[model samples]
Each structure stands twice: as C-alpha cells, then as structure tokens.
Target: MEISRRRFSALGAGVAATTLSGTLSGATAAQAETPPGKPAVRNVVLVHGAYADGSSWAKVIPLLQEAGMNVTAVQNPLTSLADDVAATNFALARQDGPTLLVAHSYGGTVISEAGLAPNVTGLVYVAARAPEAGEDFAALSARFPTPPVTSGIITSGGFKWIGRSAFLRDFANGVPRKEALVLYAAQGLLSTAAPTTSVAAWREKPSWYAVSKDDRTINPDLERFMARRMNATTIEVDSGHLSLVTHPKIIAGLILRAAANS
Candidate 1:
C-alpha cells in the first residue's frame, strides 16, 4: 500500500505516521574553524548506500543547488567500507567550505566515518544506519525483526545485490514502481563480507535524522533507536526506506535545517 502525502503533515514526538522531535543527540553548536586559508562553503555531499548508485540523489540535487547550496553525490564503489569512505572523503576534499554530509541507507555508515573530515559541519541521516565505533551492525540489526530484504539478496563473485522484486517491494517500498525499476537497474552491489566503522561521527558532529516510518528494509524502531542514541534532531516521515527518492523535499528540508543549525 502507498503512503499518503497527508501523512507527511502529521509530525509529533510519538511513534505515529509522522513525528519530529528535538531530542538530544549529545551534539554541540560550537563551530570548528575552517582549515587555515581555506574558504568556507554552504556545500552538501550526498552518499548512497548499497544496492544503489549516486543517481539515486538525482531528485534531491536540484532542490539543494537551487537554494544556493553546492551539492555533490558520491559514487560509492560499494566494494568495501574503506573504498566507499575513500570515495566520500574525495568528494569532501573537493568542497570549498563547511559541508553537510548526508546519507541514505548503508550510506549512513559512510558519512558516520567520512564525516570526521575537518570540513564537514553537520550530518543528515535519511532512513539510514548510524552505528557506533566498532559496532557489529549485523548483530545490532539482529536485535530487531529481520528485514525481508535479506531474503532478496543475490550474491555472485563475492558481491551482493538486491533482487528486483525485493527492491520494488521492500527496499524501495513506497517509491513509484516505474522509478523503483530504474533505481533497480542503476543499483550497485555490496561485498558479501560485512563492513564496520572505527568511529561514529554523529557522536561529535551535530546530526539530523529523517526516519522512514513505513520502511520495510530496516526496522522502523531500530531507526528510532539510532537517531535517539546519537541524540540527533529527528523527524519521522510516513514513507518507505527510499524516502530520499519518494520525499525529496522532506529530505531536502531536513538538510536545510541541518545546515541552519550546524
């Protein structure tokens, strides 16, 4: 079933279809000086998670750039955690000033590490994971209901991908079927071997989270736990896991908020 747009308007502090709360993510407002001799910028770097490519952010980019913000989407190789982090850092290195590092899904894990780059001023997590340093993500996920997407995994040559049926049904739950097909066609594969982070950037940098209330890929409750664990400013949208694709403005709005607060 598709979620209605009206559900977007119902924001609150409870586990409803939509929610927004200024919970403590334990982050501070103190601004770190831009690197000496480096000019600051209102830049945004987007990171896409497994089973997807940078094109996933196509809808959100225009909105951000139109608002006079510099935007770049990182093309993660999805081969390993280190490779994805390197790709993100490379994008950050190219930014002219303080940047908001944003991620969707597994991409959340990317920013949690790359965000430590001195130029990043804030973080935005959209229906994404925000694991602590050395945390066993699989173990953590196990604490929640197993997402059916796990059954949709297709593995070959040590790389893993989501089956088209599952991508449309679960991973891209609320996205239009046609667009979800395109996303599946443009999807990338992740390594079968699990990747972990050494540090959690949300612990240091101010953070914002957009929870996909109707998400089927990751347990909705788990998303809330991560957002509250980091004490992030949080919002819940009545959409699926691909909120970035289905609700670009909402994601964009959160990024703008992060930019303003950070």
Candidate 2:
C-alpha cells in the first residue's frame, strides 16, 4: 500500500508541474507579442452595425490577428438593438481576459450596451453612432444633415437595406468595386427603427474613436460630436463610410492603440 501511494503522489506532482510549465510558457508567449511600453490587451471583439455582417470587418480582422491578438467579429442579427447587444455579449463572454470592444456604424449602440460586461476594458467606435442613453438617435442624426444614403434604404418585413446604388456610391465610395459588390450582397438587414440604449458604456469606460472624413452613411460631424461628447481619443481617416475596408491599416492601428491602453 505504501509503495502504491508513493507512485500516485509522484504522478500527481509530475502532472501539476507540466500544467504549471505550460501556463508560464503561454503567458510568456503572449507577453512576447506585445511591444514594450504597450500593456497587452489580448482579446478584441468587433461589432458590425446596420447593413453589415461580420464580413464587414474582413480587412481589419487579419491585421488584428497578425499582431497576435485573439479577435472576434460579431455577426449581430440586426433585428433589434437588444438582439445585437445579446450577440455582442455572447462574443464578449467567450473572451479569456481583458478585451477591447470595437464597433462600426449602428454597432456603436451595441458595444455601448454590451461593453458594460466586466471583461470589456475599452470601447472603440469607428464611424459608429454613440447616442446618450435613451436619447433619440434618429432625431440626433436628423439635427445633422440627413445623410445621402438615407434615400437608398429599402424596407420590407420590418428589415432594412440600403439598395445597391446607395451602397456602392455612398456607403462604399472608397472601397474597390469588386469588394464593394460582395459587401452590398452580404449586408445585414437592419431594423428600420434606431433604438436608443438604456445605458452608454462609454460613460465610464475608456474609449477611442475613428471618424471617417468622407462618410456618407453617417454624418462625420455626428461621429465627431459623439467622440467629443465621450471624451474619446479620436483620429480622422480620409475615407468614406467603408473605411474599415479601404483604410484597414489605420483602423487596425487605432484598435491596437486601444488594446495597449486597455
């Protein structure tokens, strides 16, 4: 009995040692990827807004991944604000540690609500809406000149899509034609109503914003106003609404900065 007990104890110790060694190696590998002076924020959740799905982030995803960060681009069912938030939260819940929550277009509202999750360390808005909780986002945008893309929205069965003409000319102005066609075909059908969030996470969380200078889908002034209102670190990209497609490197840089600061 004593001999058997000793063998079991030795086996257990060896297993524990292996586990500890693996954990340390993993930590070292992750840390190694982060450049000095940049604290590592290893997980990133990207939320796409109305008229787009996860594929909207195709260009940006590889950039983030190449930097050795785990990135998830959320495919929100644009049925309602709550639904999209749920989808984002689902992605956030899967992250292992501190995460940067990034959003585009109407996705801003989603991250605002879902960013309240404890794992979320920061919020990054790329040409996204950032309305005050319960504020009328439609009315707010109306205060700005109605974007030209508004004319192209076609609605049926309570879901909305910007027709190909508007998507090509206004939403995807700077994107290559071949790629823009794929985006148009795969755009999410958004809810016609722009619902307000109950709470804006940017109210307390650290944040960053990228404003597309030639955006026609959402007013650039509105994006700037929201960024200023949230006191977010802001950068302006000289691209249209699809800056994530045409100016991915700048977007990736902004996100990396957010990750470092998170």
TM-scores of the candidates in the order shown: 0.85, 0.85
Error of 2 at 44 (Å): 0.2
Candidate 2: tens digits of C-alpha lDDT, residues 136-240: 988899889888899998989888899999999998998889988998889888887767799999998998888888899999899889988998877777779
lDDT of 2 at 116: 88
lDDT of each: 0.80, 0.80
Task: Using TM-score, give the best candidate's number.
Answer: 2
TM-score of 1: 0.85
- Return the lDDT, model 2, position 56: 86
Q: Relative to the unseen true structure, what is the C-alpha lDDT of residue 220 in candidate 1, on a scale of 0 to 100? A: 89
**Where is model 2 more than 4 Å wrong at Cα?**
1-38
